[model samples]
Target: MNNKSLKRWTFLDTINAALLIVVVLFMLDFQNNATVSWILLAVFAFWIVTVILRNIFITRVMKDPNHPMHPQPGEKNNAKD
Candidate 1:
């Protein structure tokens, strides 16, 4: 990826982090002693954990190859045919 793409990805990462924090906080504030509240909280927890792990693993792969996030048009054309 070029500098521009890298910057865009960084922005996306920031948004994800913010949303995760909001979800966690929502889980805490939810005032219901029902099964549904518990289930929702668990789902949010799973999503947050998965996002963290995926970012860690994918980041390594992304750096190994140039244009990890995006390829030039000609480069992708070669793979198609």
Candidate 2:
């Protein structure tokens, strides 16, 4: 039930990281402009919260027995070929 693999970088992780950089850059660029600076900061905070919530969701799914990662009581994996 370990989710070590989920901790690895995914496409979402890459995009999030990229967006984070963009947001930070925008925030810096708008330092003198309070409106734009606040907007960029809010976007960055939203991104951070979303990443945290996504990880929480993935963890929940991984722990669910009915999830694809775990086979049902009488179901056999068809991977033997």
Candidate 3:
């Protein structure tokens, strides 16, 4: 993958790490369990959205010329076409 795409993937990884930390800290803090549950739910939802969007973006990037993930012409992907 190009440097730009690699950077984006790294950024997404950072976000995922931050979310995991937040959830871990929240679980460790025992007070306000209800609020913590809601916050964790939101965090999980945001993570899911980011992953889905990232996949869509990567798929688009793979279609661009010169992208490392782009399939070569006349080469078949694993998926049946």
Most lDDT-accurate candidate: 2
Give candidate 1's total backbone clashes. 1
lDDT tens string, model 2, 1-81?
432334424677688789878767654665478787778778778877877786676667556878765445555533221
Give the per-residue lDDT digits (tens) of candidate 1, residues 20-78: 68766764444565565677677767866766676665555455665455444444422
Best of the two (1, 2) by TM-score = 2
Ranking by TM-score: 2, 3, 1
Clashes of 3: 0
Q: Which scores greater on TM-score, model 2 or model 3?
A: 2
Off by over 4 Å in 1: 1-32, 65-81
Off by over 4 Å in 2: 1-9, 22-31, 67-81
For residues 1-81, what per-residue lDDT tens digits would candidate 3 score against the true structure?
224222234655777778788777756454657776777778777877886686776667666867666656665553211
How would you order the candidates by lDDT, starting with the best?
A: 2, 3, 1
lDDT of 2: 0.63
What TM-score against the true fold does each predicted structure earn? 0.40, 0.55, 0.46
Count of residue pairs whose backbone atoms collide, per candidate: 1, 0, 0
